[model samples]
Target: MNAYTLLPFIVLIAAMFLMTRSAKKKQQQAANMRNEMQPGSGVRTIGGMYATVKEVNEDTVLLDAGPGVDLLFAKNAIGAVLTDEEYNRIVHGIEHDLKSDAGLVPDDASSLTESDESDGSAAATADDKIDLGKKDSAEHGADAIQAAEDKAAAAEAKAEDESKKTDGDSDAK
Candidate 1:
């Protein structure tokens, strides 16, 4: 085959090789992080359990999940070594403002009363802003549940009537 015919095949092979190499590099980095695990380091496991490293061994690591709660995990189950900042944030329940421009209500707005006015629109309360979407969804869910109950009751009543009719007919015979 001519070079023109083999060009696409070569490009595909090159892309695959690059992807494999990148994945291997990432795996090596994760392995390095696991190897660097030491006592007192905050680590999150692959199972999403956050714990402090109490002890490290060749094949297993003891983790302190909480007060009076220590568990053992395989060395390879360690997902990430948490930084001091991350660990502190998790422990203190601190949230980072990742989406400041997402048009979310501020924490202060949660305490607003119905009489509170904003942007010269007294009709728009905090409840109106938050409950507009949820109200429709909740109403629809309740309607569906009620309809289902009504259908089930109708079916049960029909079955009972059929049974009574059958019993009357058997007695006549």
Candidate 2:
């Protein structure tokens, strides 16, 4: 076989090798992080709960979920060990989104009720009518078609009378 015939197999082997290498690197990092866990450290669980590490066992961890509440979790369940600043920012909401909150619009519908005036009368006085933007015609033009229908009916009646007169005279001619 030509060299090109083996190119696809080589590419497949290289891709699999790279993927496994990266996965092993991540596993090593996670193991190192888990082994370095100590009491009083902040940790996020795989379940997304943030807590302080109360105790670190060989195969398990004790997390302080809240005041007077400690929960036991597997070592693998600890997703990440956060820094003191990031932990306080996330768990206690300290220094979190304060600047963004100043310019943010309210989540509730209370802002929609406000208008130019502050006495609560501006909303009602703004526009009482819902205008369709159509001007009224002097003559509505609806009767334009009605008049044609009436004229057609009148001509039909006259033609029926003319047919009665023509029937008797046609045989005589």
Candidate 3:
């Protein structure tokens, strides 16, 4: 075999190894992003759906895709998250566009008012309500309380019934 021919084969192997490594790294980065997704986060899906996260499971996420349209997708299908700054920019830009379109404010000059501030506060409050904080802890506490109460009630009922039964048996005897 010519030395030149062997050189090409070595180069091909090296290229394949590099490509594989790059793909692996990409997947790891994607996995990390998916894991970081939380409810109320803004994300765009691979399928071109953009929405705020409504729920996040180990492998899937539920999104409110506007107009009462809810969507469910694999966590891996999430394409990108809008950073806090990016999200604010987009929201403000959209608000401005909508106001301009509606002729609600003059294009020459405008200022956000007290109502706007209140509206923004309300929106943030809505977001806080949507955020599922410490779900596991809340669920566990509720379940434990419910179970303990249930067990105590059942035990008390059982004791009462047993006492009545014994009294009835003695009276009959």
What TM-score goes with each of the models? 0.54, 0.55, 0.51
Candidate 1 lDDT, 1-173, residue by residue in tens: 89999999999999999999999999999988988988998999999988999999998999999989999999999999998669867876665656754766757744454455557455554335454455475559888888899999999999999877756567778
Q: Which ten contiguous residues of candidate 3 have the minimum total lDDT? A: 106-115
Q: Could you give candidate 2's per-residue lDDT for residues 66-165 as a string of tens digits? A: 9999999999999999988899999997766577778877898657656767776867755566558864455656676688899999999999998777
Candidate 1 least-lDDT 10 residues = 124-133
Query: What are the Cα lDDT values of the candidates?
Result: 0.84, 0.89, 0.78
Candidate 3 structure quality by residue, lDDT tens digits, 68-169: 999889888899887755665565444424445664665543244224565476555544645456556665998888889999999999999987775556
Each prediction's RMSD to truth = 12.6, 11.4, 22.8
Please tell me which predicted candidate would have the highest TM-score against the true structure: 2
> What ranges in model 1 sit over 4 Å off?
94-173
How many residue pairs clash in model 1?
0
TM-score of 3: 0.51
Clashes of 2: 0
lDDT of 2 at 31: 95
> In model 2, which runs have C-alpha deviations exceeding 4 angstroms?
96-173
Best by lDDT: 2
Q: Write down the RMSD of candidate 1 (Cα, Å).
A: 12.6
